[model samples]
Target: MNPKARSYDYTKKTDVVHSEILLPKNLSEQLDESDIELDFQRIADLVEIGETTKRGKMKSSARLAREWVLCGVPELTRAENIELFEQFAQQQSEEQGVLSMVFVHDPTAGDDMATTKAAAEGKSMAAPDPRNIHAHILLLTRKLDVSSDSLLSLGEKSDSELSNDERTRPVVPKKLVGTIDPETGKKIQQGRGLCSNSEWLKNTRKQWADILNERLEQKGIQPVTHKSYKDLGLTFKPTKHLGKNASIAERMGVQTEIGKYNESVNRYNHNQLEQTANSGITSSQQQIARSQRWIDAISTGDAYIQRQIEQETQQEKHVNSRIGQGVRRRAERQRPNPYEQQLKTSADNRKQRATELRERTIIFDRASERADRNARYRKPRINGVIGEVDRLTMKTALLFSSRRNESSSYTDRQKDILEQFANENSLVTGDFREDIRVTTTFFSDADNAQTHKHIVKLINDPEREEQNHSKTSKFEAESDLNKSTRDYVDNESKTSNTADLSVSIAPRRYRRP
Candidate 1:
């Protein structure tokens, strides 16, 4: 036998003779033994109930232990604990002589009861001893009672309701242990446990904040504020309210309160600028109205604004043009026509007659001046006189009115040409020189030749449309030639620059490795 396995004397030499062996002082000279065996299987039944029960479930170790103790009580049926006790006995037997110490046996077999009863009644048995059995039972019972009492004192709870002790209920642990973020001090949610990754948590909070902020903005609220986690009972150092970047829900809560204040302020100031624009009474008022129109027009979206601006600009231009036309007509009626030498009846009639008379006088003056200047140097010719008369008449018509047209019948507009010529020639040097005063000049020979050529061309052109077409074609050809010349010059300059750039970069290839 191993020396370490040697048995020791359980009853040692006493200090006071072991205090008389602590013998029973009861009737029949027998010690009173606890009849309860405190089987762990019965205790395990209570544990199972605590683990799976819909109500009063065990959450703490103390609660779990109390539940086990309650299951092992005599109130539970012994038949339900047969297998539990057998397993317990099997495990205990494996321990060095522990089964013999407790005298464990299946209660259904009714064998260990007799031996246990005999030993309790002061008889010998194949087990350790009746006293040892009693001690084990007492120890197990004490442990159960302690755990149950502790749980009761701590006010174990399973629901929202509080226990008699008034202690706060503990939250159920989804995980055993988890790391919390130092910054947030909130339990980080992890896939492995209850906490998550710090970055993920932050992102989630940010997303939530964004959503909340959007909702608040939709309701016309702004400027959100929320306390930091530290202020809200977290383990991290305290921080100020999340003034600009709080989660949406928290921000929204604050925004709702501020929105009322903003609404009142807006209402009070509503008419300050907007009202002035709507009241159209004075020049300043009209200006304000116009400004508001521009603002209102622009506030509408891009497409609407573009259309409105175009329409308003066009309308204003048209109205200004009509006013201009009216002014011009009135001024024309009031203005003195330069050719008119004769007086008229009414102011309007005088103005009209003055305009007509002015044309006739200008025509006469031009023809006479040309004829007198020519007659002094050379003999008169019919073609020359006709050219002079025609040129003078064209000048008078062009000068007097824009309404005169070369395309109309000559008879209709030729009266001014003949009458002015007759008036100029009617003043003879033989008797009357007063009518021959020259105040203006006439067209020169080159101009006259050019005008005659143009008139001849108009007369020779068979198709009216062909004449216009020829003129337009000449104009278009000239314009195209100018554009082409510009393009050719630009292209040549660009090509030269590009060639210069290519030549410049040619040396750069030598620098490569």
Candidate 2:
């Protein structure tokens, strides 16, 4: 019985009998009542049941009893079935160290009353069935500690009255060791009570089956196994267990939903088996064809085909070996490289230096332009803007100041800035002097005040008197080249137009006359 409260109703079962107990025969004989009160009292005595304290009230809802229904084959005699159950109960008591009360129940115990009813219906009494001879065993959850010959001292008393060590001590024997509590990260202390071990109930079921099989083997009967249909390699669908209500309805010739489900499962299993059988034919043909190919390959003994196969096998082996080596080499190359790290560091440093220099150059150029516009010596403005003449004057002064300090050794930052600027303007050459010259010439001509200021700031500061030097020297070279090109083009165009005009005038006068 599960949900174990159901075991309380077993006292109402008239066919139940107590055939086994751990106590002396004198004490056992004293318990003769066949009622629920006697059954509860006996169970409480056997397990030494105690009350649990809950909300300041003493209650006892803990499991005090467990029951099992043991059935035997119809081939076994009534005495043989009883002997089998007795052995099973005794073994369970010895292993678990708990007391178990066994009872043999006969389904035909009230056959006389059943026969009288059948006669009233004009039916004869049916023969007794051997399958109805089974046993019911009620097991105690607590182990017995028999300290004295008296049965009253056999069970555990209240744990509160015991010492701390004694209360913590196990009531049942430990069957396993080294088990740990997952939540606490500590070794689990076992030996609490009977059925506390998870394997206890499972082992009990297997133990009963083993004992029953042994008895059947001794009687020269086919042994019954406890395994499921799948475990026994059977393909049939198993039926579900019918509970009390369903069992009663079935006995009264009432069909149930479980019966319909079982019928459908059986039909499905039959179809699956048929499909498997049909597929087996195709599988057999494929197997035969494979065998025939093997036989032909062996009988023909074609040297060319055999040699070709051997060569192909060797080629495949070589290819696989090469591929494996290539993979290993690639993995090695993917590892970090020290030389590449060093080169990357060097490139990063150069880029950072270039960025700083470029920023400084822009700031210096902006300041120089602002200072030139505010200078008192600047030319008077025309239409609220300074003429190009004043801009040229500032450029000439800065250029001369830079040239004066050209002999000074340049810092690494300054050198890098100039080189980068040259590279950007596509003016770099193998000669350092020529590269600098071309870079400066482009900057001066393009009105790049930023580069010009950066260069002047890198050199020594010029005096105020240097600004008054004639601007004639800076414009003389550019002015002469421009004047020569403009005079040549004007002279050629004037000569050609004069010749065309004279020819046209003569033709018009001749036509008018």
TM-score of each: 0.13, 0.38
Top-scoring candidate (TM-score): 2
Put down candidate 1 lDDT per residue, 366-407, tens digits, no spaces.
655655555443333433444344333333323222113343
Look at candidate 1 and tell me the lDDT of residue 139.
13
Per-residue lDDT over 103-173 for candidate 2, one digit per residue giving the tens place of the 0 to 100 score: 78776554433445557888655543435677777666555443334343335432222335444545533
* After superposition, candidate 2 runs with Cα above 4 Å error: 1-18, 22-41, 44-61, 112-130, 147-202, 235-237, 262-513
Task: Report lDDT per candidate.
Answer: 0.36, 0.53
**Lowest summed-lDDT stretch of 10 residues in model 1?**
15-24
RMSD versus native structure for model 2: 42.3
Q: Which residue pairs clash within candidate 2?
A: none
